[model samples]
Structure formats: C-alpha cells, structure tokens
Target: MDPFFLYVYRKLKRKCTKELPSCSLCVRLGKTCDYDGAASEMNVDQQVLLDRIRELERQLEAGSGGGTIAEISAFPRQGSSLVNPTYTIHRQGFASNLYFLDPESFGPAGVPATELDPGMPVPEQVRFILGNRAEVETVTESYYDTIDRWFPIVSRKRLVARLTTFEPKTDASVALLLLCMKLVTQILPHDENPRTGLYWICHQFLMQVEGAPLLSLTLLQATALMAIYEIGHGIWPAAILTVGNAVRLGHIMGLHDRDNAHQLFRANSTLTGREEERRTWWGVVVLDRIVTMGTYDGSILTADVRNHELLPCTDSDWDSGNIAPFGHAFASDLTGIQIGHWAQVCQAAHALGCVQRHRVDEGHAKNSRLDEAQQLDRTLVSLAASLLADMKQRGDMAINDPKQTGSRSSVDAIALCCSARFLLYELYACNDGKSNISRVSSFPSGQEAVMQRISLQGINECVNIMHQIALRLLEPQQHSTRQSPESYITYHAGSIFVTHALYWAASECSWIVKEGINAAAARVMGDLVKALHLLNDRWHRAGDYIKLLEREETLSD
Candidate 1:
C-alpha cells in the first residue's frame, strides 16, 4: 500500500461524506463547476498545460500526503463496491476516452455534499430578499391611518350624494355610509361630541334635491332624531340650534307652497303606507316641537299645554301608568316607542316646571324656575326609570319575536333602545346630585330605596336587543332579482342604523356596567366591533364592484 495513495483515498472518502470538490480557479471565478475537460482538450501552449497540471498535483499532495497503499485500500474509495464502476466516452470523433464517477459514489440518495452552517442561519447571499422591518411598520401604520381617517369622510360624502339623487340603488353607497358611521361611533366615546359637519352636509344635499318635497322626510327625521339624543344629554347645543333653523326653513317652504307640499306629502304618504307616513309626519312635527322647546322660551310649555288639550288622555291612562302612551298614536311599531319616550321626557320637563312654580308661590325660593327645574330633574330620573323598564320588556319581546323581520325597523328599534339606555344614565346622573337637582338619593332616606327599586334589568335587555340587531344587520341580505332602488336604500340605511346601535352598545358597556350590574354590554360591544369591521370590508368590496360596472359601461358606450 502506498502512503500517498492512502492519503488521497482518505481525502476522497471525506469529500464524499462532508465536502464538495473545489477548483481554486473556479472558486476565484465564483462559478460552481470547473471546465476541466475544456481546459484539457483545448489546443494551448505546453507551458500553460504543464502549469495547470502542476497546480492540480500540488493541491492533491497538500490534501493527501505520506500514506501507504494498503492503508489507502482500507480508506474506502467511494465507488469501490460496484461491478461496472466507471463509464468512458469518446471526445469529438477522436479515440480519447473520459472516465466519470457515479453520483451514488458520494453519500445516501438526495444528501447534499455539505451541511448548512448553523452559525449563520440566514445567509448573506439571501439576506437582501427579506424586507426592512421599519419600512414595513411605517407602511402598515400609514395604510391603517389612511383607512381610518379618510374612509368615514368619503363614505359619508358618497351616501349624502346618493341619497340626494334618486339613483337606482345598488348596495354600495348606503352600506358604506352605515359601516363608516358604525365604526366611528364604536371607536369614539359617547361623550366625545360627533361632528355636525357631515350631518349638515347631508341635510343641505337633501334640501337641494328637487323632487317630491317629502323625499327629504327620512333624512330630516334622522337628523332631528339624532339632535334629540344630543339635547337629551345636554351636549351639542349647536346641533339643537341647527335643527331648529332647519325646521323653520322646512316650515317656511311647506307654508308658502301649500298646494305643492300637500300634493307631495300625499303622494309620499301613499307610497310609504299610512303608518310610516304618519310616523314621518309626526317626526317632522316632533322636530318642530323640539326646536320650539330648545329655542323659544316658554314655547315647549305652551306647546305641551296645547297638545294636552288637543290630544287629551284619560287620567287612568296616565296613572295606570304601567307604561304611558307618551303620545297620541301608539299603533305603528316604528314611532310608537320613540313618541312614548320623547313624550315622557317632555312630560317630565313640564312636571319640573310646575314644581318650580309651586315652590315660588310658597315663597320658598326667589327663582321659582330654579325650584321647578330641580323638581323636573327628579321627574326625569323617575321617567327614565319607567322607560328603562318598558325598554327592557320591549327589547326582550323583540329578541323573542318569532316574526321580527330583522329589517330597518329592527335597527331603529335597537337604536331607540340604546338611546333610552343613555337617557337613563343621564337622568341617573342628574338625580345623583351631579347636575341640576338636589340628589334624589339624599332627598329622603327612603327615596334611595325607591329609586334603587327601579328595575335595571331592562338595560341589559336593551343591550341584548342591540346585540341581536347588530348581528342581523351585519348579516348579508339575499337581494331580489328586481329589488327597487328605494328598498335598497332603505336596507343600507337600516344596516347603518344596526351598526350604529352596536357601536353605541359597545361604547356604553363600561358605563352600563359601572352601575354594578354585569350585562351583555361588554359582549355586545365586542360583537358590534367585529360586525362593523366585517361590514366595512364588505362595503369596500361593493365599491370596487361598482367601479368595475362603471368601467364596463364606459367601454360599452
């Protein structure tokens, strides 16, 4: 056995296991395999050939030196076991033969010549393929903020524009608007005043659209209803003022063009059905009433006095009082609850005024209005308690109602329920010695017991109603093949209302539970947030669909 051969054999076996053959020139050239046959076969200078051969020999000697041939035989050449171990091929019509080693001579099948180096898990060669962390973060944050800020404004604008014009409704603009409103309401706290600019813009658009004058009724009523909410909590006096001005404008327009107004109203009334029309008509009347109460001093009192006479109720009705009519008509499901709640609030206000007058007459106070105002505050607390109970009962029924359409009416119902809940909180605060009146809790020791006896389970029930409504609205509706534009608009608007109700429920959860009762408020809030995100995503997809449709139309044109 030759020592040099043994060393070479050992080196070959080691290379088969854990290394790959390296050519210095090829390595320097940054190429994988060397052109060994090309160098050998090419006609070149003898010196160059000898130099290459010497270099190869020198590398071999360095790799394997001073080992015996017997030891080499023991060293295991990679291809020693095979019967036909080598293959020969002729080079270019010449009898020169080339020998090749079999790939299996190396290691097990599919094993690489060398293992990956653990020190550098991510190699410098492929490091650049990974993205920049900071850039990714920056882009993500910017993308989210852009969506958060711009989407609401854009959606609202589109909604106002669509509603202003009678477009063949597809579930695009209205759905987008509802989703935006829902998100905004959910993320923003209740006490944080909502921007009136959007509402004002919508109102202005509705006013300008020339058609059936009553076409604006829904929008107007929605605005006024929101205003009532703000006024109830003593937030956004400007909104109250704006609503008052708008009502005045509506009155002026309706009065001067009586025939046209009457004709349009009649037509709209006929279209929407007697109940909805009456609800809307009374909504206008209520808006007017609210404006009068908010703006003109003694106007609310006088109006109440007149309404009391014009639409008189039996004493039993007021006292049987399990739940007061609150207003004249309690037929239609839409406005019945609303009218009831508003009337109760107004009645409470009137009672407070009376109490103030009585105090002044007894010479107990110089500012008689102040005393009456205090009493009114107490009445508000009581009224809120009663309404809370009624709402709870109604909400429970709504949840259990087998025939509930889960439509826009349902959304409105949830909205009213939430509104009632908030009013209860406000009234509770007012009666807690925080605002207008002396603390009802401190009045008589028994008063606390009486007030505490007021059922708050209704708040929980209302929360549940809101939760269910939110779920229903967020659910996609199966559209009819020939659904009307108005129906589409109505559906979208209802979705928005549903989303808003959920948002309200979520936002109010902490406050709702702060009174020491764990209700569905928190769960409802979570559900609403999830539903809103879903609805927003859907709206964006719908918008893209509309764009595609428009593009197709343009191409057709």
Candidate 2:
C-alpha cells in the first residue's frame, strides 16, 4: 500500500473502532480489521510511572520510622521545643517549621519522647515540637494586638517582659501563651486545620495542670483563655465545660473572696496583682454568662452576694507597674475605653443572670419570677443609665473623637446594655408558644401586665439602639478595614442577640410591626442581613445566619 494510503487506512480503522458505523472498507469489502495498539501501551507506561511514585513515598515513610526524635529534629524544620518546661510533651517531633498542615500533627499519643531532665524548661527539653520562633512570635503578637483588647486577660507589660526577659517557665503562663497563639492562628490567616496540632498541645498541657497542688492566678486566666479558644472555634460544649472548671478553679484560689485576695496583698503581692486576680474572676464570670445567654439558664457564678464583687478597676490601674488606687465601687466618671465599660458589662451580666435565676426558680422563693425580673430590670436600667450618662457627658466631644471610632470596647458596652434590656424583655414576653402569657395580644393581669407593657416598650428601644450600633459597626470604616477575627466575633456577639430579638419580633411580635414601632420587624431584619453579610468574611456564624434567613425565604416561597 502507498504510505499516504496506509496512514489514512489506519486512521479510518481507529475511528471506526471508537465510533459505531463500520468503515467504508469493512462495509464495502465485508472485512474484519485490527486497530493500532500504541495508545494502550502509552496508558500502561503512565500507570507504571504513577505506581513507582506511590511506591517511593511508601518506602520513604517506612525508612523514617526508625529515626529518633533528636535525629529527626536535625532535619530541616523537623522540631519544636515545648516553649515551657512545665508543660512537658510526652512526644517528640512536634515542632515542625511548616506554617500550614493538612491533616494531623504527630501528637503525644503517637510519638515517643526524647529523654531529658523532667525539670528542665520545655524549650530546652524537646528538640522538634511546636513551631519555629518566628511563627510563634507572629501568633503571639497577633493575639495581644487583637483579642487581648476585649478580654484584657493578660497584661501587655507583663507578657512583653516575659518574652523579652528570661523567666522561670510556669505551666499556667505557658498554657495561656500557647492559647493566645492558637487563637491568633484561628482568627488570622494560616489556612491550617480548625483544630491545629498546636491547639492539641495546649489542650494537653492544660489537662496536665488541671489538678496541680496550687492553682495560681495565672492558671485561672489560662483556663479562661482556653474557654475563649473553644468559643472562637465553635466548640460550645467544651467552652461551657472549660468555663465551669475555671469558675471552680477561681473559687479554689480564693479569687471570689475579697478577704483572701487582701491576704495575698498583705503577703508581698502588689495591689495590681490582687486587682488582676479580681479581673480574671470577673472575666470568667462574664464569659460564662455570655456564652450561655439564650438558653435561659443562670450562670455557674450564681446571683449570690459573695459572687458579686466590685467590678474591676481601670485597665491602666490593673496594668500599672506600680500600685494604683483600687476602688470597689462602680466608677461612673471613667472613660468608655477604661475599666468602667468592663464593669458595666459585668454588672449587666450580673443583673441578667439574676433574671435567669428567677425564671428558672421553682416558686420556692419569696418573690415571684415576675417580681424578681422587675427588680433586676430596675438594676440593669440603673446601670444602662450610668453608661448612657457617661456617653452623654462625653457626647459633644465624643462625636468626632477617635475614641468612639477606635473604641471597640465601648461599642461592646453599649451593645451589651441593649442586650441586657432586650434579654429582660424576653424573660417576661417570650411565650415559647405554649405559655399562658400570650406575647401577641394580652398581657399579665395588673402589675404583671403593666411591667409587660414596659418590657415590650423596652424591647423596642433596645432593638432600635441595637440596630443603630449594628449599622455603625458594619459601616465601611469598620467592616472594610482589615481586622483580626476576634474583633468581628466580639462585635457579632453583641449583634447576634439583637438578631435573636428581631427574629422574635418578626415572628411572634408582629403587632410591634403593626403599631409602627421604632424597631420595625421587617426593617430591622433587612438591616441585620446587610450587617451580617458585611461580617460574613470574619465570622462564619454571620454567613450561617444569612443562609438561614435565605432558606426561610425560600421555604416561604
């Protein structure tokens, strides 16, 4: 056959085998034909290459199985020191230099430890665990720069001093430092797994310190940080457990008893140290209540008189290198950014917790749930008036002031004030569709009826203020600007409660909408969607809510 004819014949034969209708030659001459086999051989060659690559990977894994941790640490980026000796890891090869990991770190369960003096610092004892210095420092700096502002659990000066100057490694401090780093990685962009190996290590360390002979102030703070970590990661059950443990630990350390704290101050402790102890206890209490807000349950801290101490003094006073004046009374004259807002939040929590306790009461108490709710409402009203008064006092100068813009804490305080009021309304008005109190039309008889009217009105005001704050928070300056995850989460914490109220208003309290109320259900829902969309990037929960609203829309359609 001619060369061109032969090539054409082969191409036609291949096409005929792949497609259906027989080739012209086969149809005309009634012939059976064979196709070229080169494609089959090529596929075989590719498969062989892939198999070889996988085999080599398996072999490499097998070869590394026998290497000691110290030898493995010798490999580039294979090791991380414990960073604190008191938090001893029972494993080796944890501190890899990688910034992003795919699946899992070789945790304590899987790895063998390198022999070292048990009393040595973790950084000196373990060779290859944790992470590199630069990565660790980045996470540490990111945390202090962001989350620490709201919580103020760690003192900046003290943390800086610890990082700069060498100090004896303590389990509690190291656990807290590790948690701060973990939180930063979670909030910032590292794109690692949600539960990182670093988190597991910190968790392990915290577990080890659970029953130590003496639980220090630092230890209680560390426990609280762990709860924040769990909250940020969406681990509610674990967060609740951690918060409960922290509260108990605080009591064990005598943090709740002012007398015990005073004794500590008498025994060579600085006034600042005692204040920090006080602040940590309050931080634990506030978080305990905040995390479990909508469940209508009281916090573990309880409404006991002893549990309520003076709110923490100014952050400046707590962070001071020298002893500063400590006032147990609520300081009304302090700036919004000062410890005053923190006090307001704490007191508001106390009041709300009181209401929840009353609601859950079994009628064994002298006062009815309605009576106690009214009283706590009064208490919260007083506190909110103080916060608003402070704002009013600073209103003229504060309008264009950077403090209003930059003070996330103040924004949070105002939002909490609204939430406290909103929650009190819910306590009386939320019927759960099965109660005698019809939230829709009728109110309780007489005094209860009057209070319900006031609470309903209060709900309107609270929702309106909440809407304005949400708008301000979701404004271009706040949302568009790059920020840490903590900022968005903290902001959303306040707004989520508002969203809950709007949900109730739109569904059950449609009469509020019918009456042309200040916080119209439809209007607030629209604003909430816009605000949540803006926050969708930093907080996934906002996006989740948006999806929920959309789904509800779809279902209605």
TM-score of each: 0.34, 0.65
Give a tens-digit lDDT track for model 1, residues 1-557. Answer: 22224433554452111125865544542233433333334343443444455545545775554332111101112222111111111122111011013322322222121111111111111112112444323433432233212111122222334445522222222222232232223222223434433333333323322111222333333444444334332345554564565455344224212233322122322212332333333344443433332121223212223332212122223223222333353221222234333233333333433432332243443243334434444544455445445545545224343223322132433354354343333333345565533433345444433333342444455566567655554444333443432233233323322333454455455555455456655565555555555444323222222233335442121
Report how far off residue 256 is in candidate 1 (Å).
15
Number of backbone clashes in candidate 1 = 10
Q: Which segments of model 1 are wrong by more than 4 Å? A: 1-242, 250-281, 285-410, 429-441, 477-504, 511-521, 531-557
Q: Give lDDT for model 2.
A: 0.51
Point out the worst 10-residue segment of candidate 1 by lDDT: 116-125
Best candidate according to lDDT: 2
> What are the lDDT figures for the candidates, one per model?
0.35, 0.51
Q: Put down candidate 2 lDDT per residue, 162-252, tens digits, no spaces.
A: 5665332433355345554554335423233445445555565555444322235666777777776665444557777888888777664
Query: What's the CA error at residue 35 for candidate 2, in Å?
Result: 43
